[model samples]
Each structure stands twice: as structure tokens, then as C-alpha cells.
Target: MAKGKEVRLTIVLECTTCVRNGGNVNKASTGISRYITQKNRHNTPNRLELRKFCPYCYKHTIHGEIKK
Candidate 1:
């Protein structure tokens, strides 16, 4: 019941637009637009990026991985 490390890791994806404008999910000024998902550390050593929907923006935008 032991292992070196987990292959999959939890990551947070935030909207690039909001991030640029210093908008965070916790901040009440804007609702929120982030996705919590798992990723394979081995497969994706680099930062991950995805197109997700942002209610604040009311459209799809690029969500990039940020420092945890």
C-alpha cells in the first residue's frame, strides 16, 4: 500500500483573461471561471492549457495552468 508518487495530480485551470486582469475566483467582484481537473504528471511535464467557458466573460477562453 505504497508508491513513489501519484501518476495523476490535481491541477487548477484559470481563465487567461481574468488572470491578466487580476481576477480571482475567490474575489466576489467576479463570480468565477476555473476548472479543477487531474493530469498525468509524466505525460504533461509542462503547463497545461485548455479552452473553457467563463461565465464572467460569457464566452470560451483559454485557461492556463498557474502556480499552485
Candidate 2:
């Protein structure tokens, strides 16, 4: 990771129950600054998660990236 390097990110919208909130994940907002960390021993950014409130659900939920 270099200074001022841009990381590839995907913002997914989710509900408190871990279910897909909207029709797709890409329709979510990305205005917030996210902190990403490695999920496994390999030290790669495998897990993409964001904690945010879903207006549809009216609660905080864990939004995970949807792989194509």
C-alpha cells in the first residue's frame, strides 16, 4: 500500500439480518471513508464489509461486497 493509493472498493447495502436490502449492492452510497483489513492468514483483502444504517430497514447492518 502506497501513500495516496486508491483501493478498489465496492459498496453493498444490507440490512440488520444480513439480507440484501436493495435490488443490488452497487446501488448503495460510498460517501463514507472505509477501513479495510485482511480477513485471513494470507493477509489479503478478502472480506469487504461496511457498517452503516439502511434507510429501508431503519437499523445498522453489515454490508458485504457482492462478487460477480
Candidate 3:
């Protein structure tokens, strides 16, 4: 078997508040804000959650890693 290239994995962080409050007509949102970050597969093999700033929400919220 050929050796595979060792590449670091990256994930997207999305705001939970923006997704939940997206269905309202009166709400104003350009869209859900996302942040890209990298993680070491050997160090952490599970999903990651981070507190990030959401322009739409105007506050820091728990951003969860989402599948591509």
C-alpha cells in the first residue's frame, strides 16, 4: 500500500442561535457566520465546539463543528 499524505483536518464553526432563529420574517441576517479552524486528529478525535463571535447575533455564542 502506498503511504498517504499527512494533512491536518479543518472544521467549520457555525452559530447555533442563527440557525434556530433563521425562520422569522422580521429577522435580519445576511446568513449564518462560519469560522474555519484546524485540529490535530491525534490529539482530538471528537467533534469540537468553540465560542465565537456572530455578526448576526452580535454576541459570542457556542459554535459547533458541522459536517461538510
Candidate 4:
């Protein structure tokens, strides 16, 4: 017998604004924010984009899926 493929997949999300400015590697008032989450491969085939709070940015911004 065979088993089905994985339905849930883990993904990484990063702040768009911070990345645009450049990689804020230093620990200061600003830096790139990343989040770890899971998604259903079948339900949403496209990349996931979510609105989340960026502590570094001091506001909410769009967090797009990034490669591992």
C-alpha cells in the first residue's frame, strides 16, 4: 500500500518593507521580521501573503512567503 502526499507545509514569511530598505542585520530600532506558519498545499497553491505586525517597522505590513 501507498500513502498520500503531505497536505500541510511549513513556510517562512518576512517583512516586505524591511527587506526593501536592506538587510537590517544590526540589532537596533529597525530590522527584518520573520514568521513561521503552515498552509494547506491543496487549498492554496499560490504563495501566501499575510498582514502582520512588524515590531521593527512599528506598524503592520504585508508579510510575503519566502524560501527556506
Residues 1-68 of candidate 1 have per-residue lDDT tens digits of 35648889889998998877777544556755789999999999999999999887778999998777
**lDDT per model vs. reference:** 0.83, 0.44, 0.78, 0.88
Order the candidate numbers by lDDT, best to worst: 4, 1, 3, 2
Candidate number achieving the greatest TM-score relative to the actual structure: 4
Model 2 C-alpha lDDT per residue in residues 1-68, reported as the tens digit of each score: 77435454433433434343333334454233222332332344664566766554445667655443
- Model 3 per-residue lDDT tens digits across residues 1-68: 44334446877888887778772313655578789999777787798889999887788988989996
What candidate 4 gets wrong by more than 4 Å, as runs, is 1-4, 24-27
Candidate 3 error regions (>4 Å): 1-7, 23-26
Better of 2 and 4 by TM-score: 4
C-alpha RMSD of each candidate structure in angstroms: 3.5, 8.2, 3.0, 3.0
Ranking by TM-score: 4, 1, 3, 2
What's the lDDT of the predicted structure labeled candidate 2?
0.44
TM-score versus the correct structure, for each prediction:
0.78, 0.39, 0.77, 0.83
RMSD of 1: 3.5
Against the hidden true structure, what lDDT does model 3 obtain? 0.78
Q: 1-68, model 4: which lDDT tens digit per residue?
A: 33448888999999998899885634677568999999999999999999999888888999999999
Clashing pairs in 2: none
Best by lDDT: 4
Off by over 4 Å in 2: 1-13, 16-44
